[model samples]
Target chain A: MPTAQGGTLYRGREGMWSWVAHRVTGFAIFFFLLVHVTDTALVRVSPEAYNAVIGTYQTPLMGLGEAGLVAAIVFHAFNGIRIILVDFLAKGPRYQRVMLWIVLGLFVVTMAGFLPRHLMNVFGGQ
Target chain B: MTNATHGTPAVAERVGTLDAPRSPYVRKKTTRGNYELYSWVFMRASGVVLVVLVFGHLFVNLMVGDGVEAIDFAFVGGKWTNPFWQVWDLLMLWLAMIHGTNGLRTIINDYAERDVTRGVLKGLLYLAFTIVVVLGTLVIFTFEPCPAGADPELLASFCTA
Candidate 1:
């Protein structure tokens, strides 16, 4: 009876964390897409309607949420590539830990590059 | 139903024989060649492309010029007017929809206990995915920034200006 939950909770490895993050981020993005499509479809209605809906997303609170969304997307996309490589390449699983570190490094670098400007846009008084 | 061995004697009999044959169902692996392999490959490929398409979309919409505030009806219209942006958006729409749908299908198959339930849920998911993708593609390609003979008041300012 070798079950996935047989082990203790906090004793998981990088692979476990990556799997968890992938599922979480995948669900997050899917839900966001639902709302995004609905709102964007408002464009077919009228300009004022579309703009008004999008205007609500410009709030400071939504700004933070947007940043979180970006982080989720960045991690998910990077980890996804790693998973893909691990599936296709024979040597991929061997260096998966190293790949995870690389993914994290890239995530941090890309976020650092984008987040500051995004934060400024959100909080900067137009 | 008469096979219900009730009471402590039944429990005692089952205790040391845990390794005995369990359910009547025989688990056999079906050989579905290459479909799953190709699907796995597609997930990675589409995912890689989606990263670029999604990030580029975000960068252009949220980072360029006035940032989030710059997004408006005319803003979208302005983008869709260009063939490059139209193609970009169309690809993003199709790829993301298909990718996300497949991911959800996987989730449903993993958790759904009954075959009927899985089938129903996946059918509904595919239906919604098809509608959204089709409508989205149509809108992207056929969108009229300003419809002819439309009321000027309801239209984007650019239309009248």
Candidate 2:
């Protein structure tokens, strides 16, 4: 029987949470890629078919979904770099908690820059 | 064998030593040599490149002048018509698919305990990967910016020129 208890160093903390987020986001992004490729392939069918499919992506609902997707990508990208550092740098494990904070900071900043422009484009009317 | 008449109870002949089992000892090497090691390295390497490729893609497509609203057949045709954008998208498609496929493979292995279950999930995953990669590559290579029968309104402006 596994208990909720975690040892002093790794579990029940930033390290575990980051890993969990990484997996969840990666799972979502993978499925999205499959669907995206399929949709894009509609171009080969005909211009009308392609436009009909892509038109849905411009809707407000899908725009919000895109924002969420971008958020996931940004976090995953920053955290991925952190993971590389952890793998290659000698001092990586020691400063992993700090690096996670840095990753989060970058996520916030990137999304801040992205969300407003995307939302305006989606809702601002052509 | 001791005789009962000698005051020692008869004992059946021992088939094997108590310390060792009857089955032959075969070492269980759980991993195929270096396959998983290479996968781990590939994930990291591809991840770095994907960060660059994917970020640039999003910035150009989503954060540029009109964002998602500007996307349509014309937008796509215009971009794919250029050799630079063609190569960029091709690389993005291949690298992203491979990276995502490998990530899903790791997830499937971690969660799916049964051999049959793991095999089935991975089979589907790889199948999807193959179809998407081949389709995307062909689309990039075969796309026509202007089809004679296509509605001019739907085609890129440059197509008419």
Candidate 3:
């Protein structure tokens, strides 16, 4: 039997870590979505107000923050798909570890494609 | 598997059987058939779609053309004018709200100790979720980036033209 201590500390297999990561990432995205919706809703108030709010996001600090958000989103999305397969497919739980590696591989590749472009847009000269 | 009496200790001594066994802990079984199963399935399906919708939104708003600087009222107005973007934004709004709300519902169920507390918290959560989603959907569909009656100075420059 698994001990509560081990489970709490995430001292289990890849599946456990994935579950924890999913929860963490889910919370992060949830909070961000709250703020994002409020800010986007500013558009309905006035053009100036909306632009001013979004303009704050153009700074170097926010650019870095955006990168972190993107990373959270990518990991959560990839892991979520893995979870779906495991829950739905007959052979999925048996090969979950293999699927995890595939998810990680996809995450890295997608991030590689996204990061350079995002960084260029943020840091590169006009 | 036998229908043992409530006061009988024999039920406790019995091993696993084909019949459903009682547990010390109270199990919150679902009354609705396959609802939870479908809900789990929906999370995955919506999540996959959200990945695409959200990434596309970020890519366009923060990376395309002049990038983040180009995003403003007029820019949004231009995009919303296109049926494609309108639908995209609509899907993103609905999917993300429902997905996030359901995830939080799960969290609340897991963590909340008291039934009343859990119900109250979930009630509030659902209320907030409904308000935001409904308002957002309305705004997306009814948005006029440049209202004719609005103050011209406050309106986007595109509106003045």
Candidate 4:
């Protein structure tokens, strides 16, 4: 018997999350890249001006902003890799889920390694 | 020729109840080669690696060296001057763009109803990928730490006048 909506619970094409994640990450990376380009472009203006631009980034707010940038790039790259695999290789649906979890686990691990170094530089004054 | 199937011999299988089980709504076909299995492995593997590579890139660029304050002409110039950072940035760029494009390709195939639409969308996607990846790679490799005959103060703090 069908559900209230009269459709099977999870009957549809393959790799739903992979598609969604790719789009979400793509937009996110685009936004981050725009900001990055604009900021980097400041260096071309003048030395002191570039210095001034860079100086503003030292604030805690900027650090937090960067934290987000890191996350966005990571998700986009990893999920994008997943989509690439699906399109070119034709992997299994069950295996895709397994790999996604692996990506998540690695994300956490890498963040653990990097965040400390960043926080040390930021808050600890290292 | 016969009325239907014209000279085609219709040989009914001798075995009874021999068909493989399948879901009612699901299409049944013999599974393809192990290539798909490998693709599954690549996604997870690349995904795991990307998380590290991409995040490391962001942290270094945006957060390191006096946080964002240290970032400037000198900042990027200094970073890219080192082959190590250059490689890092390059990896991040290549990986993310390819990944994103592949993801979008899947979406196009799943959503687009007509073959023509799918082909057009994929063509556009590939074009965009080419432009971004090429531009980004060039910037990373060819960037000059200092432009000739440029104002010093306007340049990065580290650049010699």
Please give the clash total of every predicted structure, in order.
0, 0, 0, 11
| Cα lDDT tens digits for candidate 4, B1-161 | 25236654434332353556673565567578685566556555656676678657666664566554445566677787789988877886776666566656666776687899999988998887887677777777767777777665545556673
**Per-chain TM-score, chain A, candidate 3:** 0.90
- i-RMS for every candidate: 2.8, 2.0, 3.1, 5.9
lDDT tens digits, residue span A32-120, model 3: 88788878888788777888898888777898888889899989988888888898899999989999999999999988988888888
| Candidate number achieving the greatest DockQ relative to the actual structure | 2
The CAPRI class of candidate 4 is: incorrect
Q: Chain A TM-score per candidate?
A: 0.91, 0.92, 0.90, 0.77
Give the per-residue Cα lDDT of candidate 2 at B107: 87
Q: Give me the candidate number with maximum lDDT.
A: 2
Q: Rank the candidates by lDDT, best first.
A: 2, 1, 3, 4
TM-score for all models, in order of appearance: 0.82, 0.87, 0.81, 0.57
Q: What local lDDT does model 1 show for residue B46?
A: 95
| Each candidate's DockQ | 0.45, 0.66, 0.43, 0.21
The CAPRI quality class of candidate 2 comes to medium
Worst 10 residues of 2 chain A by lDDT: A1-10
Q: After superposition, how far is residue A18 of candidate 3 from its true place, in Å?
A: 0.8
The total number of steric clashes, by the backbone 3 Å criterion, in model 1 comes to 0
Q: Model 4 segments beyond 4 Å from truth?
A: A1-23, A30-126, B1-41, B156-158
Off by over 4 Å in 1: A1-11, B1-33, B148-161
Model 3 regions more than 4 Å off: A1-11, B1-32, B149-161
